[model samples]
Structures are given as structure tokens and as C-alpha cells.
Target: MARAATATATATASCAPRLLRAALLLLLLVAATRRAAGAPVVSELRCQCLQTVQGIHQKNIQSVKVTPAGSHCAQTEVIATLKNGQKACLNPAAPMVKKMIDRMLNKGSTN
Candidate 1:
């Protein structure tokens, strides 16, 4: 009977660590999901100039405009005005321009 008790205790102790690890992993997953859901939606735009430069090997874009649209997590409109007099409005934030705009807007709020 003592031997059986010792075996049971050992098994219980081993199970405790596994349970704790599982709980920690579950908490981490929940936190990550919440963070991702709370993140802002960024939008992107592409114009004639962007298309033209994309074909070139080493072309630099001149001007890009990123504007925030809507109050909620909905789609945002971005306007890209290139140096070549081409304009384009796109929904879904452009990665580079969206980062820049978000940073600028966030900074403006702190002041």
C-alpha cells in the first residue's frame, strides 16, 4: 500500500507541472489573440507611378500620401500622389506609408 501511495504521489506531481505549462500556454495564446484583434487596420494605395517604378531595377518613388479613413476598424483610404502627376486611392493601408502615418498620428496625440 505504501508503494502504491508513493507512485500515485509521483504521478500527481508530474501532472501538476504539465497542467501549469498548459495553462501558461493557453494564457499566452489568449493574450496574443487579444493584442492582434486590438491592433489598428492599416491601408495601402498604388498609383500609375508606383506601377511604372515597379518595373524598373533601381527606381525611387517621389511622393506618397497616406490618409486615415473611418472611425472604426473598417477600411481606411490612402491616396498616393506620385511625382509624375499620377494619383491613386486605395483601400487597405500600405505597409510603409501606413506605418509612417500611424507613427505621425500617435506622436501628434502625445503633444
Candidate 2:
């Protein structure tokens, strides 16, 4: 009876480390996959925002013009005329920027 009890205790103690390691490995794998899956979406959004800003700068824009809704953009886009009188497109997803755009639209409509 004493030997059986000792063997059972030994087995449980040895199994604990293996169980802990397996659980740790499972958690790491899940975290890695989640990060990998979501990374592209985050990067793409940043890329699109930067690209839109770059395009606007390249055109040497003057004042920004906002449309309540746009045919080409996801939400609203800002149109600006350059010193050379060329039009440029700007993204309006940022909070502060969107507010400014709303003000611009409202002010324009009033006049």
C-alpha cells in the first residue's frame, strides 16, 4: 500500500511539468496566429492614409474642400486646389481632421 501511494505521487509530480509546458506552448501559438492574422489590416490602413496624404502634398494643395459623401473614397474626401490650380484628394478619417472638414462644409453651405 505504501509503495503504491509513493508511485502515484511520483507520477503526478512528473506529469505536472509536461502539462504546464504544453499549455504554455498552446498559448504562445494562439497569440502568434492572432497577431499574424490582424497585422495586415493595421498596416494596410496606415499605408492608405499615408498614401492619400502624400498624394495631396505632391499636388501642392491650397485650401481643402470636403464632400459630405464621395463617389471615389470610402467616406468623405477633401479636395484642394494647388497654387498651380490642380486638384488633390485628401483622406478624412482622422477625428480632428473630420471635425475640421465638417466645419468647412458647414461654413461653405452657409455662404
Candidate 3:
């Protein structure tokens, strides 16, 4: 009976570390999932890409690029890189942005 008790205690002691490791792994996964789920949401405000081209532009946007939102925003986003290396986000489906995307697509197709 005493030998059986000692064996059971040792088995439980060995299992405790594995159980703790599993619990820690589960917590890390949950944290990572929560962080991924908290990704930036798409804004409702309509972006005017043309405005960046006209008038006294403060942004000085050098280039505009399309970025597809995967599991986050659902909609596509346009990122405008400024001359000073700053970036601004815009709506991809906006008038000027759409024109840019279409132009790029057409250019790629012809190549």
C-alpha cells in the first residue's frame, strides 16, 4: 500500500509540470488570438484621394498603394506614402484610388 502511494505521488508530481506547461501554452494562444482579433477596423469616413493631389497639400503624398485587409477590416485599404516617409490610410474604393488601382491592373495585364 505504501509503495503504491509513493508511486502515485511521483506520477502526480511528474504530471504537474506537463499540465502547467499545457496551461501556459493555452494562455499564450488565447492572448495571441485576442491581440489578432483586436486589429484595426475600417473607418466609415469617405477618403478623398484626389484632394491629396490638388490645392496646398499638407500631406505631400508621394505614392499610393493598395493593401488588402485579410481577417481584420474586410475591405481594402489604400496607403499613401508621403515624401517625408509618412503614411496615410485611405479608402481603396474611393474615386481617385479606384482609378489608380484600375490603371495599375491594366498596366500589369499589358505586360
Candidate 4:
């Protein structure tokens, strides 16, 4: 009976470390998963715009966002937010968008 008790204790002692290590690994994975879930989502991996418009009236535009060419996109993108809350992708090569970009640049430089 004494030998059996000692052998049982020995087995439990060896198993305790492995069980603790597994518990720690599980906790780390859960924490990592929660952090990844909390992180901001990137809606699209590629460019946001696929089609482009020729022009838009300055009065109709409430805001403009310009994205430069990079790994995600090959060409410059110009997006205009209209007063009605609609977003339109403008052609970067379009005269109106180019002028708008120039105006925005000049305005920024003066500030």
C-alpha cells in the first residue's frame, strides 16, 4: 500500500508540470485571439475604387480623399464626397480632379 501511494504521487508530480504548461499555452492563445478580434478591421485588401468618374462640381463636393499609388493600389485614387453624402471615385487623370488636387495642395502650403 505504501509503495502504491508513492508511485501514484510520483506520477502526479510528473503530470502536474505538463498540465500547467498546457493551461498556460491555452491562456496565451485565448489572449492572442481576443486581441486580434479587437483589432481594427481593414475592409478591403485592394483599392477601394474600381470605377472612376470624369468630374464633379466643386459646389457638390463636401470632401475629397486622395490615396497615392502603393502596394495596395497601382495608381492614384481621388474620391469625392458629395453634399448629399454620396462618395464618387474621380479619375486622377481628369482635369477637374487634377485642379482640385492642386487647389488642395496650394491651400495646405499657405497654412
Which candidate leads the pack in lDDT?
Answer: 4
Clashes of each: 7, 0, 0, 0
For candidate 2, lDDT tens digit of each residue in 1-111? 999999999999999999999999999999999988877642223122224453443335567766554333355556667888766566566555566567777998999
Winner on TM-score (1 vs 4): 4
TM-score of 4: 0.66
Candidate 3 per-residue lDDT, tens place, 1-111, comes to 999999999999999999999999999999999979986566533433332332214347687777565654455667778798877766555576677678779999999
Off by over 4 Å in 4: 1-44
| Candidate number with greatest TM-score | 4
In model 2, how large is the Cα lDDT of residue 15?
Answer: 100
Return whichever of 1 and 4 wins on lDDT: 4
lDDT of 4 by residue, 1-111 (tens): 999999999999999999999999999999999988887565555898899999988999999999898877998889999999999999999988899999999999999
Give the distance in Å from residue 104's predicted Cα in candidate 4 to where it truly belongs.
Answer: 0.9
How accurate locally is residue 73 in candidate 3, as Cα lDDT from 0 to 100? Answer: 49
Candidate 2 lDDT at 35 equals 88
After superposing candidate 3, which stretches have Cα over 4 Å from the reference? 1-60
Pairs with steric clashes in candidate 1? 42-93, 43-92, 43-93, 43-94, 44-92, 44-93, 44-94
Ranking by lDDT: 4, 3, 2, 1
